[model samples]
Target: MPRTNRNGADTKFRAFSDQTRLRILHLLRAGELCVNDLVEIINVPQPTASRHLAYLRRSELVITRKKGSWTYYALAPAANAFHKTLLECLGQCFDEVPEIQKDARRASKLKQQGGCCPR
Candidate 1:
């Protein structure tokens, strides 16, 4: 496959195509989190979470720092500008869609309460 242009919409859309990856990015927006946290929240194996993290790191969307045995990941400030804008637009669409609004509320409650409602 040809390499995607760094500033192209195709690259951005490709990055957000994977549901797991998108969830990981969303969670990272809230705060820096370790691979384990992403694995838990994304309900994926550690290796899978790590793979996505690696891809995001390579794309410059996420940055990581080693702390003891753990490596924590966070959204890179420069990378997040586009994502933040895109998510804000999506947020508006979700607000306009009642079903999406309900789902978002339910998911937020689950996250706040430390529960993973089986997908």
Candidate 2:
């Protein structure tokens, strides 16, 4: 988990402390997405979704790419073996979580329907 000395493993764990952040990360497990995609799937306001994404970015748990006017985010490659394991655990850890499951299903449907995110 050696992203930088500024934040240690504790910060990474803290990134999971918020349910919104957890939901965002779990949804991102599938692939990169625009913020609006998350906002729609999670039923959160755009600002709220962006805030959580910013938190994850600061934690180095995710990375971003700019496509024209939109910003897309995805799980970053782990900085080390432990970090790799932690990222892998995200999907398994929340497997039975009702909220997480609902998010995933909605995300799938969004893709199937060609996504209304306009990204």
**Which residue segments of model 2 deviate by more than 4 Å?**
1-4
Candidate 2's TM-score reads 0.91
Stretches of model 1 off by over 4 angstroms after superposition: 79-84, 87-119
User: lDDT score, residue 109, model 1?
Assistant: 59
Q: List model 2 lDDT by residue over 60-91, tens digit each.
A: 99999997788999998999887888888897
Q: RMSD in angstroms, candidate 1? A: 5.6
User: Against the true structure, what is each candidate's TM-score?
Assistant: 0.66, 0.91
In model 1, the clashing pairs are none
lDDT of 1 by residue, 1-119 (tens): 99777655676677677766767776665667777666556567989999999888776678888877778888766645676676564434335455444444544655686643221
